[model samples]
Target: MPVLVAVVLVVAGCAAAATRLRVAAPVLLVVVGALAGLVPGVPLVEVEPDWVLLGVLPPLLYSAAVAMPATSFRRELRTISGLSVTLVVVSSLLLGLFFSAALGLDLGWAVALGAIVSPTDAVATAIARRAGVPARVLTLLEGESLLNDATALVLLRSAVAGAGAAVSVGAVALDFVLAVAFAVVIGVVVGRTMLAVRARVADPTVTTLLSFTVPFLAALPAEAVDASGLVAAVVAGLVTGHRAPRVLTPRDRVSDALSWRTVELALEGAVFLVMGLQLEALVVDVRAQHGSLHLVLGVAAVGLALTVAVRAAYVVLLLRSARRRVRHSAERSAWLDEVEQRVERRVQHLPADGDTRAVRRVERFRARVRQARHDLDYVLDERLGPREGVVIVWAGMRGAISLAAAQTLPASTPDRPVLVLVAFTLAGGSLLLQGLTLPALARRLARPATADDRASRTRARMHALLDEVAAREGQDAPRVQVLRAQRTALLDALEEGALDPDAVGHALDVLDAEESGLELRGEGLRTS
Candidate 1:
């Protein structure tokens, strides 16, 4: 425990430095861990893969899902589904074939390797976000990464169970369909039930405890029934997050945010650090066993290359299809607008009484046509183009999930050392190679944020904060009224240009903190 504490302290320090330098935190932590492992008297850390899957994964995934904007997620559902499920399955198959042929591995082991490395890591996605990737592309990548793990894991289980034997494809497909359906139902049921429970509890501490517990509560049962726990956790998060604005008090949200961020940083750092330590140990193990380092490295390199290539190809094809559809929609929309205008002009020329009804009818038709065009544009806008697609493709760098999945592979698997080495090396190489260049690529691909975009984001945040303040009911209402009045005065000053925008923002934050503190005390009083 003492050594563990020391390791965490060191990793935390490194993470802080990485953030300050604008480098990827996970990559830096991994490098630090590798060095730590190399130092004499520094014991190597070994975390059970099951610990990660059950304990670390649920909360990390839940936090991310809750943090996601529920409306945007729903809006981009189709695109997210394709990238998360369809692309993951496709990439896994292609990589499995490549690895099996290239490395002379059994088909099942090859498929397992493919599944192990397929999903884009959340750590890599975070690095890409720092690189200035567009919000839309980032959302798609995040959504895809969060859900793809379950898909890859499902495929992996089948491959591992088959042990290189041919499995029935139709049966696998049926299982996938059923697993998703069951997972969604279970997730929704758990999430909604938890929301009600939290609402009644009223005690902020108990509410926070429920927030932490809900992920595992939702996931483990689903996994027990052979459904996708990843999907369950994500669904639960989405449902809870959508309700959180109303369900959780300002104090609860603030406390939960701080606690979760701490948990995320610690777990993320520990995962990568342990991986680096494992990599160090793995290198020594392979050398002692007289295994060919060159062969393992060669296969890992090939596997990484194939993973990126498959993703890039899929992105290119998807972009082309989306572009063609957008062009078709625009053309049809132009024709519709022209016809609508012609009808209105003809209606205007008719006799007064007869044309009045016709004019109103034409107006209604035009409104519907306008709405149709808007709907089409909304759908098109969510689809990835070449630039966004490139960002998503590069953001496919691996992290904790890949390493954890590698460790879960059964001991009897052929070339076990080789597989483990490749998994570790592939993950590290992705971070060092892809993580290093992702920011540069994202910057090149990203469009600059427009003024309207900035304003929209600002407006949305203000409304959300104000809505929370409004929703804080009970014994604290009197104190809340004063805070609200002060907030109004700040807004008035900002509107009059008497106060700087930044100053008003800072003041509002301070006021929000004060309000939250009061609410927290009130909740305590109520509990007593």
Candidate 2:
């Protein structure tokens, strides 16, 4: 425990530095663990399934889910679900079938492994948000990462059991359905109860505890009943988050925001750090070694190649299909070539005096404004209610679990157990490697080519703020010129993607109507 604590402290320090360097925290955690392992007496951090599948996953999922705008789910339910659910099942089967054929693992065992690996990655997808990726891609990847794990896990358990004995196809199918349904139903019921309890509590700390306990309560009961613990945890979290805004006061939200972020940071660090330590255990048992390390590496290489090939093919198909559909819907989306051409048009607009820095900030806010607009339209066009709850639920990807599961190998298997370990290592690596990197790659590939009305948006908000202040304090709102000056400064900061919507909203609030030289007797003055 002391050694682990020491390592964690060192890792926490490194993670802080890595954040400044713009490196992913998981990447840093893994590095720290690797270094810690080199010390002769540095012990490993041992984790039971209870710690991993139960303890860690729920809080992480909750923190991520709470921030997911429920409205987005209502709007993009079909597209999001298709990517999260259908894609997960398809990818899992492909990975499983490939492993079965290439590694000589039976179809069942291979499928089990595939199911385990299929989920995108909750941690990676969540982390990608900070990397300047578009919200739509983050929505799909993060949501899929959260939900796909349970789907994969349930399928894997079914596949493994069926692979061994007289289990029927009916049996596996029943297990899969029951696992999901039971967990969802249980989670919903428990989640509603928790929300009710929280609505009655005014204390922030107590309410936060209520939030923390909801997932575990939902998960444990579901697992105890042979249902999906993970699914239950996720659903419970989504429900709590879905209800939080309405039921809890702003103080509650503030408390949650702080607590959740701390939990998120610590838990995420622990996850990758622990992974590095425990993955060290999936090694050779000298007495009954399965196969040559070289052979395992070979299978892993094939598996990695297959994953990349499948993913690339899937993306091409997805992009093509989406483009064809987009052409019919909006009439103006750029073709791939056009999008590239747009970069040229945009580049020419760059200030020749090397003010790329200023241009870049303007460009970023324009991008955010575009996305904010897209998300807003989605909220409008889609009929999102509780049933439209697909966003938070579907956003459940499982990268960390898959990595942790890789560490759970029995250290020995079929005289060629090395093959299994190698396959897992390869698959896990691809998941970490691709999952961590793909959003960035995807953002680069398909970032929209057009810009939007940041200047106008800034002006409009400033006007609104000014009008409100004039009403409140009986003073004229700030002048249009002053607001414009403030906006110029704000846009400069926002261009580098440093602006928060709330901060922007607050900027709007700073413009008092009374302060802007407009006044009326018990009536607000409108901005010019």
Candidate 3:
């Protein structure tokens, strides 16, 4: 019953959000989940860890990866690599150190805590991407998010191992490497197989379901082999996303994208609502334990502060390194800025034929990468990338997992619980408080909205002109005299404020018809 209610709430939340925020559906789902917690007797259901890491994470990551052309991802590997691999590891270490010291917890234990929560989920990044963030910026955020989950989860397992003597440091390190490598292999294998299956099957719905199951299948194998289930699921999605294009027909391609998006949205909402509802258990446990209120606040503050500081520092370093490399590469290129521009222009003008399509595609992709690289060039580049990256990093906050981790903590003794009430409180609060606000916080740090006045006015004028021009001309205006008469009629319509912005849309539709008519005839043929 609660699950059904949650689904109803999610649907209503999406509708309301469309009218109010104009943000992505996932963001609204999260808000719905958090807010719904306030209703009395609304049971806070504990979402299974397997379901979260295996079921929810995979499709979301896959959908995000697929929405992006595989070409863009390969081209922007540098940006993605920095965020996904380097920053994740560094942030995990820094956060671990901070929490351990500030909260009077064991260093190893704190590091374990940090590792588990280190990776940000793709849910936040995907929603942010749809909200009009830049391509490279979105890539960086999403890539980091997609890959880091595995790394963090591995660290989490390792952290759990320190509690026992069964696993040695060297063995743990080897296992981590194996887990990562295995996740990649499993993901690719599953993805390739599924893509082949999708090609054989024409039914989009079946293909979609098959795509959905790949993650679950990959996750089981990875977990059976003591690997990261999150990593396995993500890799499976990524591989399948990147491959589905070649295997499926154009219709399948369309269906794949649509189905991926729909599945991702549904799963994301389910996860966020589950995250919020689960908060009750943590709250109850902490309160019952009579945990130190000050301690909880302190720990939460420390985790929040550390996450912020390390992320800021990481962004600064990444931008600095990218800038330095850019300058060095520029010097090595012997100032080929003009040459690069010429190449780009040539690529743009190249005839769109089947044979040249491949070459043109490559050139165009490289051009986009070059442009992104140049923009991240010397112009106070430090400030923009660093700020954006840091904001995203903070937005990576996860409270539900931390709360789960707290619950997983064993009793230290009869009088003392190893899962410190304060820690659990901090975890739950961090998930709810920080997770809920991160998107808004990230948005505020972005540059102010620039005036689109000139573009807007030109567009408005064109739309007004086309609409009036079309209505007057219709299908009988092929004669120059008829065209002139149509123009006059269009003028009269415009004089009546028929050129209003909303009406411009209708105008554009007419213009499209006019253009289509022209295409069907020789030069100078006009459409009514």
Measured by TM-score, the strongest candidate is 1
Name the runs in model 2 displaced over 4 angstroms. 168-170, 286-291, 324-398, 406-420, 435-528
State residue 390's C-alpha deviation in candidate 1, in Å.
2.1
Give the candidates in order of TM-score, highest first.
Answer: 1, 2, 3
Candidate 1 segments exceeding 4 Å error: 328-383, 449-528
Give residue 183's error in model 1 in angstroms.
Answer: 1.4
TM-score for each predicted model, relative to the true structure: 0.81, 0.72, 0.69
Residues 127-222, model 1: lDDT tens digits: 876776665677788788779898888888888876656778787787888888998999899999998888777667778877888889988999
Better of 2 and 3 by lDDT: 2
For every candidate in turn, the CA RMSD to the true structure comes to 7.6, 13.1, 10.3
State how far residue 324 of model 1 sits from its true place (Å).
3.9
Model 3 residue 143 CA deviation in Å: 0.5
Worst 10 residues of 3 by lDDT: 496-505
Candidate 3 matches the true fold with a TM-score of 0.69
lDDT leaderboard ranking: 1, 2, 3
What stretches of model 3 exceed 4 Å from their correct place? Answer: 5-8, 11-15, 22-40, 102-104, 166-170, 335-390, 399-528
TM-score of 1: 0.81
User: lDDT of each prediction vs. the true structure?
Assistant: 0.78, 0.61, 0.59
Model 2 — TM-score against the truth? 0.72
